[model samples]
Target: MRIISGKYAKRNLFTLKSNATRPTSDKVKESLFNSLGQFFSGGKVLDLYAGSGALGIEAVSRGYDQAFLVDVSGQACKIIKKNVDLTKEPERFKVIKTSDFRALKQFAEEGEIFDLVFLDPPYAKEKIIKVMNTLLENNLLAPHALVIAETDEHTDLPEVEGFELKKDHHLGRTKVKVYERT
Candidate 1:
């Protein structure tokens, strides 16, 4: 896969060979970013369930200051490191090899907050709500932080009290929802 826009636009990224991950398609990535404001000025990002670190890398490429890419798979973590290395600014990206919950807890304990977060867990084991709640409870989301959730079309995410659903669209077989903190 390749970055679609910004400083690292068109830069190539590597994907894991295992069937455990599904990299977000270029078309969907472009659409999702467009829906989230096309580009960012500068802010931190978290890519939970990061497959190839594409989403977080794209955010950094498009002007986000830093990104934390977390994945449970060893292969995925290696691929994410390789992809971040391509940017030539590895310092801007941090690859964490751990489960999503553990990563969230670590970030929370460290008083880390993000301006944006990408949640694209495997379709079968969707935990968007649980993750969202953890982020909220831990104060790991900056005021008005934006969250982009990618899921199978069959999944439906309910509206939570502290978040406002900004956009909800179906792109092919995928469902993309953008939520902003209230």
Candidate 2:
């Protein structure tokens, strides 16, 4: 996969060649960013299920100040680090190897807030609402922070009170739902 735009546009990235992870395709990533905003002024982004770190990396490429890429798998973290190295600006990215739950706890402990968060957890283990509630309860979301939740078309994500549905995009079986914090 490769970055589709911004400073790192066209930069090729490494992806895990395993079925355990479904990296977001360039087409969908581009569409998602376009639906929101292509470039950012300055803000931190969190990629909770950073399988290939593509989404977070793409955000940094598009101008987000820093990206925290968290993945449960060691192999994924290694790949993420390698991808970050490709940017030649390793300081702008933080790679963490941990489960989604632990990552959230760590973020809370560190008082880390995010301007954007990408949640694409494994389809079968989806608990988006719970995770979002944590982000909400812990004040992890900056004012009007945007969240992009990617899931298969079959999963019916319920509406959360504090977030407004920004965009509901469909591309074949893949569904991309963007929510903005209120």
Candidate 3:
């Protein structure tokens, strides 16, 4: 996979030979950033279920102030770190080698709030609702924060609390939903 825009645009990211993660496609990533527009210029970002840190790294490249990438896999974490270093945006991002549950709690305790959050968990897992609740409960989302969720077209996400759906789109087998924290 590769970064499609920003300072690191067209940069190749290290990929792991595992079925544990799915990197967001360039088309989807471009659409996501396009939808975000200036909100990412200097906004704080969180990439939940981060795979190769492609989304978060792209945010940094696009000028986001900072981004936190959280993942449960050691291999993914290693690749994320490498990608950050390679992009030379290490100062703009951090890698959290922990499960979403633990990272959510720690981020909250540390008073880390984000303006944009990317939720792209594994498809067919049905974990988006639980993760959204945790994000709200931990106050990780800043007021009016924009939360983008990418899932398989078949995945049905529950109407989560503390946020209102602003937009929903379907691109072939991919579903993109944008939510604004109320």
- The models' CA-based lDDT, in order, is 0.91, 0.90, 0.85
C-alpha RMSD in Å of predicted model 3 compared with the true structure: 1.6
TM-score of 1: 0.97
Candidate 3 wrong stretches, greater than 4 Å: 123-125
Give RMSD to native, each candidate. 1.1, 1.1, 1.6
**Alpha carbon lDDT at 136, candidate 3:** 86
Give candidate 1 misplaced runs (Cα > 4 Å).
123-126
Top candidate, metric lDDT: 1
**Reference-based TM-score, model 2:** 0.97
User: Which tens-of-lDDT digit does each residue in 1-182 have in candidate 2?
Assistant: 89999888898999887888999888889888888779889899999999989999999988899999999999999899999998999999999999988989899999999999999988532478888888999889999999888888888788888999988999878898889999
- Which regions of candidate 2 fall more than 4 Å away from where they truly are? 124-126
Cα lDDT tens digits, model 1, 9-70, are 99988998878998999999999888777888999999998999999999999999999999
* Candidates in descending lDDT order: 1, 2, 3
